[model samples]
Target: MAIRDVRAYIEEHGLVETADEESEKSIWRKSGFEGVRSFGEMEQILSRFIREHRDARRLNRAQVGIMVGLHETIFARYERAFSKLHVTRLIHLCEILDCSPIEVVHAAAPHLFGDNRKEADDKMKLILCILDMPALTAASLLAMIEGLVGERERSGD
Candidate 1:
């Protein structure tokens, strides 16, 4: 069975939470996400991306549906988050939208895609730009900093 079906079974059987107000939910909650909640969130993000790209491209629902081999009603439901889209359909959507899967992923959950490292690297570049230093000078400065750090480590400081 699909993960959604499993989630539905668990919920229907009261495995996640009790009907009583005093009872808390399951032990499976993490970062505000349960299995079914994750699916819903993904659907929302994907639907928004598809709609935005389709509108920006000035493509109508019928056009996208024909391009992706889906009926217009189904495509409309997909955009409205009334249906789940498979991975293959998502790839087809990306191709029709003229966007890459990486772009969609970065848009959907940027936090999961090395965004902190990218932001830090960008800040470092900004700092270098503000300093107005040449590339060679920046390289030399980084080397000096590394050397100093190594020396301090070796001296147990």
Candidate 2:
């Protein structure tokens, strides 16, 4: 479904406002996301991702609900955007679906990966490649990356 449709559903269900009543801000306006333009889009992306992952695994809402210890209707609310998906609940759902929580986050905010789609896609591909590597190889790469990052930090890059 389109984000607009999800947004409409959320509005219709009276789920659009937080208790704080602050206006929604673009993700980029927050610290560490200075250039992002996506605003208030994560909820839609998250709902879609959850539903897609569940479908891909051939699991119904009831099955996933049992795995996550939530009632089927409660879990369905999340996928239907009638309720917000908290981080802890997202982690539990991801575990049950055998999907990476980071993947869902990436889908919600690709700008976190890079400044543009191509750059983001490249970084995401690199990340997936690292995940597919042998454990020792992955560890070696991690160490190398750490060393490079440390050096860059020391050099004020």
Candidate 3:
């Protein structure tokens, strides 16, 4: 189905307001099953993508770090998925790997970015301009996002 149709269905059913719980229940009742991922699941997907891309390119952590102006230890942490990635650094990593942000993001969040290819491509470019920061900042940003999501849920707006 088109994204518009899916959005209309979700709105009509009050699914987005309910998060995955209500949506999954309704989908499972209608169909046989529904799959929902936790935040860690998405993280793992993204981590695996980075690791696989590095392996495919035959680039070691040290090599990637040198290319990206980071130390080998820091880059190793990123490769191991132990570091919280800033979008700007992720963009640089993509450039070094000769890959697209849209590709990586979509691989990590297919349910979100896959259906809308053009939109994903546009977002990839726009996010490149986001400021670089450490993992702690990324964690804080995630917390803020969760807070906003909670507020939206509570306000039902």
* Number of clashes found in candidate 3: 0
Q: Compared with the true structure, what per-residue lDDT tens digits does model 2 show for residues 1-157? A: 5565766666564443332223544211321243332333567779999999999999999999899888999989999877889999999988888878878878877767886778877988888788789999999998999999999999999
Query: Per-candidate TM vs. native?
Result: 0.52, 0.70, 0.52
Report model 1's TM-score to 2 decimal places. 0.52
Q: Which 10-residue window of candidate 3 scores lowest in summed lDDT?
A: 26-35
Candidate number of the best lDDT: 2
Worst 10 residues of 2 by lDDT: 26-35
Write candidate 1's Cα lDDT for 42-118 as tens digits.
67888999999999999999999999888899899999988987888889998899876666665555444433647
Per-model root-mean-square deviation over C-alphas: 11.3, 11.1, 13.4
Query: Can you list the residue pairs that collide in candidate 1?
Result: none
lDDT of each: 0.71, 0.77, 0.67
Ranking according to TM-score, highest score first:
2, 1, 3
